[model samples]
Target: MKKLLLAGVTIAMMATPAIAQTYKFAVVPKAMNNPFFDVARDGCLKRAKELGNVECIYKGPIEHEPATQAQIIQDFITQKVDGLAISVADVASMTKSIEAATAAGIPVITFDADAPGSKRIAYIGTNNKDFGLALGKQLLQLRPEGGKYAMVSGGPGAKNLAERVDGVREALKGSKWVEVQGSPTFCNDDSTLAVQQMSDLRTATPDLAAIVPVGGWPMFAPEGFKAFVNKNKKDIDSGKLTLVVADTLKMQLELLRDGYSNALTGQRPFEMGEKSMDTLLAIKKGQKVPEVIYTGLDLVTKDNVAQLLK
Candidate 1:
């Protein structure tokens, strides 16, 4: 993320308006306020300034919602922005708005999350399925027998979450465990939601050996599942429950250190933001660009966290 964000700072400086560039750009993330994209947003701003005439803006729903994000995209179209960078909140619902953006002669390139059916020029992000596969492999390594594991997905049907979970399913197909139960929880980027979901999932499945949350809200929520644990400290302290997940929150990394979480699937959000800016610049200057650029993925665990955190 540092490298990518720094690259944006440099690019924004070098790609000044004197270079025949004037653009109004916008990026929509899953939500408006998360440290993950807070870093990315900083990069976007730096690039916008360095490009001189370039004006960049970012808008996202207070929580992760496709309808709100789609509205933001339409608003960008009405404003006639040169380019739209969307990190889709819901893949299916955002398709039409994306189509409209292109129809208005505005190019769209999606980052972290995606609207696959839309006519975006390119997608700059990780191969989410591969990320899920990596998560499953790590879980297996931790518990080779692969006992019944439960998932607390951030949202019921979010595309990126679904993809990572699908990858986990594919990897676990031959393993010796049937999914006893799981629920799609919504933290809505709020700690209260975490409290609610934790209470709900504990009520839903009491016997899950491991609980995995592939979504950031649940995996990183400050008080996630703690309510249930507070009531059942004996259950948790007795080592009856285990956990696994993918995310980049520093607290989650700490949990990894304490053995509460086995691993994390990291998406280079800063890289995505920086590279997306680079992609837009290439297109503006009439340079060829790849239709899809993989930003890459990382698996961070207790054993490797020291190196990864460094």
Candidate 2:
């Protein structure tokens, strides 16, 4: 009996730390193949290593959609994840699943995009309004004489992109010369596809003064928009089309420097991952985190582009 009790105690001791072992967190983006979210995933993984024993799982659909994100969010809940995050592709479509995750007691942080009314605890991404306002301010600087400019973006239903697109329009409102003429084209987060779409739009509009690709991915670099520019470099050079990208993607900086992008609006990818882990660890440690943590953004221009780019 004495030996058995000692054996039982030993087993308990072994089980304690195992039970206390760090749990899994999930990072779900709009799509599994997107290079943009992969950067954020890269940051999350890098930071996950520093935390030791904590695991960060990344999953998403083939295409960027709210339903797929919701499904991934539900899977996290079913798997009993410690935390979950999403760069919402569609806001309204994700509401129920986000609520489901909340019901399961797993806190969720929205990245890249957000659902303002959802049960999500916080967002760890660019400030959309600031992104918009900054773009507005930048547009005036770029074309002080303000002429007809068109906007290209992702889905019209996308919350974050819409904010930036709207902000650009608002900024150009005061400039009588800067008319936003062309119909807004969708970027869909695929550089190749975006290029093709932009090319078609450019072909249709005879006087598309400037192209504003709001946010990361398509607008960030011309190579990403090559479907249009690759065939018409002369047009881009002749001043018929000037491309304005949203955020600076690290790997795409070379393309930007090579003249594919006029400038890029940059977001803090590494810090986003680090901050996200910090938030989860804080919650695990019985600490309270804020409902909103606004990770700001910056603009990258030809002048100081090499500073961070290199």
Candidate 3:
């Protein structure tokens, strides 16, 4: 009888689960190949290290396929990660997956690009409309007497890009000199595609005044930048075309110095990662986090571009 009782007690103790001390959080991006996302991952990992009791998992789709992002989120769900920070590629397609994550009792927050209608706890990135408004403001400074300008962007249906385009139009509303040439061209986040579109547009409208890319997709490919410089150098030199782009990554600063682009808009991607982790952790702890969080932006120009280079 004594031996039987002791064996039963030992079995019960062994079956009891140990207390969980470390947490795992997953950070999902629009695409894994972009260097911009790598910066954001650095921020997320830095925050995870600072917390000392958390692990950050970074993953994303290889391309911008509609199902890839949603599928990755579902995989994270299956892994049962403690929290998720995502930059959704498509809002409508992702809503159900985001809601499913929420329903699974996992905390979800969005960074960079937000799915506003989803159940995401908070948004941590630039206010994209304001981002566009600022870009338009800089364009005016470059060409206050603008003749005709064109915009290059990621996806036409992308929420963030659309907002920025709208802001650009709004900013140029009262100005008679500036005219947005046509509907913003969508490059689908392909730098090569962006280069082709810009080349085609310039060919069609030889007197195209300015080329403003809502995102610096094309500049990511050195060949694309080289093509732009080679093809448009004369126009740029003659002040017939001004190139202003968003996202002042290191490559962009180099482009500014080499006179390939006129200006760049910088976003705090590091902060996007750090704050996103902090917000997701807070939500998991049943603490309150604001519904919207706006990271800072910087306008990089030749006059002050040297500061960012360092």
Candidate 4:
């Protein structure tokens, strides 16, 4: 009887399940102000829930400040999170923090914006150069007759936006359809400032045939969004102006619907957020991931806008 009791106890102990390991992944965006990052956060949260035992902590500075972003990274490092994914606001400033995270045995990855020189394992976001080329192509399709254009962009120092602008110039090389009007008007990722800049551009170049905003700042605000479309409504209707920008969020899609915009190049920000976390988890598990993961882009026009909306 004693032997049988001991055997039953051993069986019970052997049948017990092991506790699941929990991973904490921190997702730091360039700024928390933009709706784009909000969508990205949603993706991260959804994926985190789907991937049980993994917690995704999405955070960033309210403004586009490199120092602020760096501090956040540092805090996360101190907290000893399992891994980190960042969309660096400033490449130069954030490199040190990224290196520090890696030095401490934490894996880091970038999305939306990248710090390519850092020790990050992978970059997951749109190919900015190709994105610009696609924008150039859309411009050509909109108006084949050469005309003037301007770029409303984010920070001048942002490497990704600069790359897109360079690609735009390359695509327009020797082209008769359009010519760059002036230096890029930096919006600084402020929605109000974006509207003001657009208004100023319209005033300075009433003949502005095409406007390409590398990042969709104004469209994040109801007022800014309405103002950009309403102000350009006449020109768009008369075929005198062509507005094209990066990002295809629902509001931008509406602009495409209302004829206020000629074309909108969309980024897979949701996938960026989702994959960033997943990649970090894989890295934590000692699984190898790619150095660069391209999320892909989509061109939304009047034709297929409905499909996307539905």
TM-scores of all predicted structures: 0.84, 0.87, 0.91, 0.94
lDDT of each: 0.71, 0.73, 0.85, 0.84
What shift in Å separates residue 276 of candidate 3 from its native position after superposition? 1.2
Clash-forming residue pairs, model 2:
146-177, 146-178, 153-187, 219-245, 246-265, 247-265
How well is each residue in 1-310 modelled by candidate 4, as lDDT tens digits? 1222564563323445788889999999888998899889999999999999899998899988778999999999999999999987888888999999999989899998888988889999989999988888888887878588888888776778888888777777788855555648887788788778877887888888877888888677756767777867888788888888889888878767876677888998899989987898888889999999998989988899888877
Over 4 Å off in model 4, which ranges? Answer: 1-13, 177-181
Better of 2 and 3 by TM-score: 3
Cα deviation of 273, candidate 4, in Å: 1.3
Error of 2 at 15 (Å): 15
| lDDT (tens digit, per residue) of candidate 3 on 1-310 | 1222564563323454766577899999888877788889999999999997889999998766658888999999999999999887888877888899999988899899988988988899999999999998898898888778888888655798889998888877787545555648988788788888888878888888888888888788867777877888998988889888899888888988888888898898999999988888888778999999999899999999999999
The per-prediction tally of clashing pairs is 2, 6, 0, 1
List the pairs of residues colliding in candidate 1. Answer: 12-50, 246-265
lDDT of 4: 0.84
Candidate closest to the true structure, highest lDDT: 3
What is residue 238's positional error in candidate 2, in angstroms?
Answer: 4.2
For model 2, the stretches where C-alpha displacement exceeds 4 angstroms are 1-20, 177-182, 219-227
> Ranking by lDDT, best first?
3, 4, 2, 1
Taking the tens digit of each residue's C-alpha lDDT, what string does model 1 give over 104-194? 9888898877667778888888788887787777777767766667665655446777788788878778897456644445555554565
